[model samples]
Target: MTSTGTLSRAQGTALCVGAVLGTGVISMPALAADVAGPASLLAWLALIVLSAPLAGTFAALGARYPDGGGVSTYVRLAFGARAAAAVGWCFFFAVPLGAPAAAAFAGGYVADILGGGHTTMVGTFLVILGLVVTMNWFGLRISGRAQLWLTGTLAALLVVTVVAALPHARPANLTPFAPYGWAGVGAAAAVLVWGFAGWEAVSSLSGEYRDPRRDVPRATAAAVLVVGVLYLAVAAASVLVLGPALGDSPAPLADLLAAGVGGPVRVVTAVVAVLLTIGAVNAYLAGASRLGAALARDGALPARPVRTPRRSLMVVTAGSLVSVTLPISLHTSMLLVTGCFTLVYVLGTAAALKLLPPGWARRGAALAFVATLGLLVLNGRPALLSLVVAAAAVAYASRSTSPKIRIPSSSSAGSIAPKPNTNPVESLP
Candidate 1:
């Protein structure tokens, strides 16, 4: 049986926007300033350009397949089961590793609101995770109306910050543009991509769209461009207002706004920041659950009670355990997951190139895939590690005797192939 309900174009776009413009927007500026300073703007620009076609490729793939498993399904259709499984495994690892960190981030923000130390912060983290898991478990839709309100409010907050800080702009902060060299810019770019990774998550729900082929790609591209511009604007504003000081502060925008505007604006900004983080959590929880369900349906995971209230809770429990056990810091875990996602996109774009028929468009997609692979690998160690693991997964899958689970080729009813009849060996008469 197939499920019916899907998102409208606007909802799809909002989901994509929400996924990309998560807590990273608030946190990444500081990291960028530290690693690349003014040069980080260039890195942002590079990513903007690189991510466009990369995202577009995903949008196109989703439009074509319009199924639940976003990147995994795309890769599977273009390559084969082994390649698909590798992508799925990488994505699965990336999300679990990153979830705890995200919970930690939410905890920190909650602490900011309630005034607490590490113990309170951890409690807040678990509470927030549990609440979000419950919300998803209960079938909260994050409807178009909700997305509009959250996205609009977040955009307004950012605009307010940028406008308030414009008077403080100092071009001097941009000097020594590559203060830490181009390498730092590359590192920042890799990290920044993490902030933008979820744009494709929106496309995974293409099967639910009213007219996925027409709507999904358009919404995906629009969301990417809008978010890219927002990031650039915010990054530039951070440099202008906070300069080198931005590097040390976690909530640089809020701090800059608090210092510049003061009074009620500070409280308001704080509230919006919390909301933005919540939106991120919402998007992540929803996307991850759907991806898990898709994988389960494909027999990639042990078939469990998917499409149930319990699934999100299960993921949250697993996320909590991972958060406690992992040695890597929250920020570093985000970067590592971002790196894993980049590798996923590299394969995704390659799949797009292969699946799309030969043409100028196909050639362009192939070029973009190559470029994305290069950028992803530029992270060196993490990128190399992810690649090695993917290779191992592919090798294992190729040798395994697992059932070949295939999606029916035709969309019409009665398309499913019938099983052949087999008779047991007869006993001697």
Candidate 2:
């Protein structure tokens, strides 16, 4: 069989790291701190444990069928065409909306660093998005190097925050830990999942990896472990030092550092936050653009301009706009998009279970999928709505009539004309 696409192992890992370590790290603690202080560390631990196996499944899928479509390609192989299309659409929506939100967030942080103003905020947002879009359009190779630098910088900042604040941690801040109770923990876990959601996206690039079957899983597990620890350290430190104040501050990390290192630290922290968000936006732009291109190739989307670099730039730009304009708090948006992504994960996990024979591993995957879905529901109305929208899109894509290419049973890589069928949905595998 001929390979249709490819990505290096470093690129794959960068994609995962970029997806996980975004502005959410700076924002999530504040939103969930009121409900679960250091206890939220438990949530991060759970995500790390859960994401590994799910990531392994994606790696396996990618190794076996290294198509450009990523998760949608796996779904097509296991379920059918319509199902794959729906999954693709869900991912497309989530990524684009997420891009703009991240850009806006970075802009907001940049404004803070520059003494703050609406004009600066909007201007920064547009400039950052434009820069990222240009880089992606030009097929930039700096993403991997950028990811390494950004990850190191952010990790150092968290470590410093943790060490500086350790002595100041208040026991009382951790008391009444579950103020919102188990339900609140569950709700926050839903949002927290977003911070750890991109591991599978890495697997989607297996075709590009030097040795996907081995490297993808290793990178995914390692990245999750590293990022998970970083998150826990930051969360614990923020809760210990900031205590009740954690819930009120938008830039909790900066606040913690400024308290320990003086006012100058705020400027440094703000700069890092802006860089963090920009890195995330760039990564998402690459991912979402690739995903859109894959879907268009499959005829799941309209036969529009998807292949050209300019078209891809337009698509990423438009998505960034939506991310900026979406209602609901950033925390809420993270939860909602994450819930939609969780549904994508459920479908993928179920596909893995179905395509693979009955075994202990499959059973474990099924359990994790079910548990994650339960947590997703706990994210409340907005998350539920996102899930509902995803479902509807899947159903429509499955039933709609569209031109499709058929892969022949032979190992050769030629496409065949679409044949009329009683069933409207097209099957890829």
Q: What tens-digit string does per-residue lDDT give for candidate 1 at 1-429? A: 232434677777777787788777777888777888888888877877776777777776666667666788778777887887778667765666666665565456556666675665567556656655655554434444466678877887787788888888899888877889888988888777777777556655666566776778788877887788788888888887788888887667677787568764545655665666666666666666666666555555544544322462375458656665767776577767777787887888888787766665466578778877776876667676577668766776666554554544423211111211100011010
TM-score for each of the candidates: 0.86, 0.85
Q: Encode model 2's per-residue lDDT on 1-429: one tens digit a residue.
A: 333223455556656766777776777777667566556766766766776677666665555555456787667767777888877777777877666556555666667777556677667778777767766654535555566677777777778877877887788888767776676666567767767677555544555455654566666666666676777777777887888789778678788887667657767776777777776776666666666666666667654755433464477578667667656676667666787788778778877776554665577668767866776676667667565666776677766665555543323222222311101011111
Would you list the clashing residue pairs of candidate 2?
6-207, 6-208, 7-208, 7-209, 101-323
Over the full model, what C-alpha lDDT does candidate 2 score relative to the true structure?
0.66
Q: Which ranges of candidate 2 are over 4 A from the true structure?
A: 1-7, 308-310, 326-328, 357-364, 395-429
- Cand. 1 TM to true fold: 0.86
- Against the true structure, candidate 2 reaches a TM-score of 0.85
In candidate 1, how many Å is residue 97 off?
A: 1.6
Local lDDT at 401 for model 2 = 67
**Local accuracy by lDDT, each model:** 0.67, 0.66
